[model samples]
Target: MAKYELNTKEQHFATTRLEAEAIVTEAKEDKHLIMHKIAEKHNKYGEYFLVDLTFSYNTPKEIMGVE
Candidate 1:
């Protein structure tokens, strides 16, 4: 996969992503126990776009404030 580098300004609007997974014996279950690993990346102040990577199971839990 190709990744775009993060610039300084756009870093402020960055989102969080991490490697995580849920396991369940049944596949049809609507929900599985969700767990996330502890890892964080800071967005720089000069970047023009958002974060540099896309990930799985990544969602906005809450929007705290604007950049």
Candidate 2:
């Protein structure tokens, strides 16, 4: 069986490629969020394989004002 792993600040795993892709697509829809697919690898653990997908993004910062 092959598993797909999506990495950002945290890790997410999906059993199918479509599921993995869906996660990325949803993330992209956020207008304030910037995301990139940094790396991808296959056959991570021999028989227990994985398609590892790594992503990089900017974390949103909030500004505060004091009167």
Candidate 3:
């Protein structure tokens, strides 16, 4: 099983890639939101996130058996 998520000041979890992407698109378009640094992290469980270190926004797309 895998999961996806979008994070800003808050963490938003999604069940599919499409949903996650939608969240990202929305966040990018939100003028009230500040997006500075973003990073991708791969964990042992194959879960990864596009993260902003300060507020720590994590967009995670998990694929089974993938690093």
Count of residue pairs whose backbone atoms collide, per candidate: 11, 0, 0
Model 3: per-residue lDDT, tens digit, 1-67?
5454444364565544565566677666655455533444556766444533223334343333245
Estimate candidate 2's alpha-carbon lDDT, on a 0 to 1 scale: 0.46
Highest TM-score model number: 2
Estimate, for each residue in 1-67, the C-alpha lDDT of model 1 and write its tens digit.
Answer: 5333322211112232211112121211424223212234344643222322222332333222221
Clashes (candidate 1): 11
The lDDT of model 3 is 0.49
**TM-score of every candidate:** 0.17, 0.40, 0.37
| Tens digits of per-residue lDDT for model 2, 1-67 | 5333323543456556666677677766755344434233457553221333345433223112211
Cα-based RMSD of candidate 3: 16.7
* RMSD to the hidden true structure, all candidates: 17.7, 10.9, 16.7
Steric clash pairs (candidate 3): none
What clash count does candidate 3 reach? 0
